[model samples]
Target chain A: MKLEDATPIIQLGEHLLVSMQGDLDDRAVLQLESDITRSVSETQATGVLLELSGLTIIDSFIARVIARLAGMIRLLGAEVVVVGIQPAVAITLLELGIGMQHLRTALNAADGMALLHEIRE
Target chain B: MVLAIESPESVCSIDSEASLVTVRARVRATAVDLGFGIVDQTKLVTAASELARNVLRYAQRGRMIIEELDNGDRRGVRVTFEDSGPGIADVELALRDGYTTGDSLGIGLPGAKRLVDELTIDSRPGQGTTVVITAWDS
Candidate 1:
């Protein structure tokens, strides 16, 4: 499935922003990784901001895919930041033993963009 | 003496990726009906997602049963997943973190265990597997 059909990838001044809303099935999650990675390289973005406030749950599979996406974007020379993790999801992720230390994160979209800019500098 | 009351059980078939989403929604609705708090609801839904996916991944297809429980003082939700696939060879290893035979992160079983109040697994090498998880209102 095309990335646009699942989630839109918008370009914002050298950074690409993708907002994930609602429940995304396993196929969509995997598609997002490949789509985002390609968009980063094609756009030559300096950073990528993933907005995840609309996601109610992040299972192990989703978490692993997100982490892997971050690593892939970094290899393409762009930093990735995840923002808008709910308090409960954060607690559950920790309990699930997925710290996601390799990825940078912020509380919301504004903060995430700012962090991305700081990292790009 | 506290009497236990159970609501009518609902079952969802897990035969495709879309079924995974359906199961999570069903569990979330049941959790809400049981008066589970936000955190508890999220934990239960997340655990349901993991186990449902396991059914699709290992057995190729399975079914999940959701039921509401009340013991006069406490309310809870229980989800049971059953699949007729190649059963787990090592239940203990399967429940450990970072142990997987497929192309997954290997945290589904153990992680689901950590998210709820109770998790039980019954599997035979060649017969099938059954996993049940329960989370009480907190």
Candidate 2:
């Protein structure tokens, strides 16, 4: 399925902002990874911000996919930041040890963008 | 509003990845209807997802039963995943974090335990494995 039909992944300027809402199964997560990686190279985006404010759950499967996607995007030369992780999700992830240490995180999308800028500068 | 007082909701014949996703959605919806907060619902659903995935990855077929748990004033959701796959040779090692038999990350069992109040695993090498997890309302 196309990324647009599944989730809102918008290309703004040189950055790709993805807003993940609702339930995301394994297929959706894989699709996001492929779509984001392609978008990074095609748009030459300097950064990608993933917003999870609306996502109620982030299991190990989803967490691993996010980590993988960040690494993939970085190889394509774009900084990736995840924002709006809920307190419950954070607590669960830490408890589960799916720390996702490789990816950058921020309190919100705007902060994530600012962090990307900071890294570029 | 709690209906499982009569009979627990059951999802049978989970033999593929797609079935695992269906189980997660079913568990999430039941948690919501039982008045579980979003955080608790996410925790239960996430735990269910992890266990369900284990059933698919290892056994290739399994069944799940979701029930409303009540102990006096306490209330919770209990999910039991049963599979006839080759049981773990070392349950302790399997329960340990960062231990995995397959290529995927070893976050299924331990991570699932942390997400719930009670987690129990019953398995034998030649028999099957049954994992039951319960998350109480705080």
Candidate 2: TM-score, chain B only: 0.91
B15-62: candidate 1 lDDT, tens digit per residue: 999898889889988888878888988899999999999999999999
Per-residue lDDT over A8-64 for candidate 1, one digit per residue giving the tens place of the 0 to 100 score: 899999999999877888899987889899999899999999999888999998898
**Residue by residue across B1-138, what tens digits does model 2's lDDT show?**
443453634555678767766787788887887788877877888888899889889998889987777776777777889999998889899999889998679989988998888999999887899999988887
Deviating ranges (above 4 Å) for candidate 2:
A1-5, B1-8
Q: What DockQ class does candidate 1 belong to?
A: high
Clashing pairs in 1: none
Winner by DockQ: 1
- In candidate 1, position B27 carries an lDDT of 91
Best by lDDT: 1
| Model 1 global lDDT (CA atoms, 0 to 1) | 0.89
Q: What is the TM-score of chain A in candidate 2?
A: 0.92
Residues A22-70, model 2: lDDT tens digits: 7776787887789888888988999999999877778888888888888
lDDT for position B136 in model 2: 80
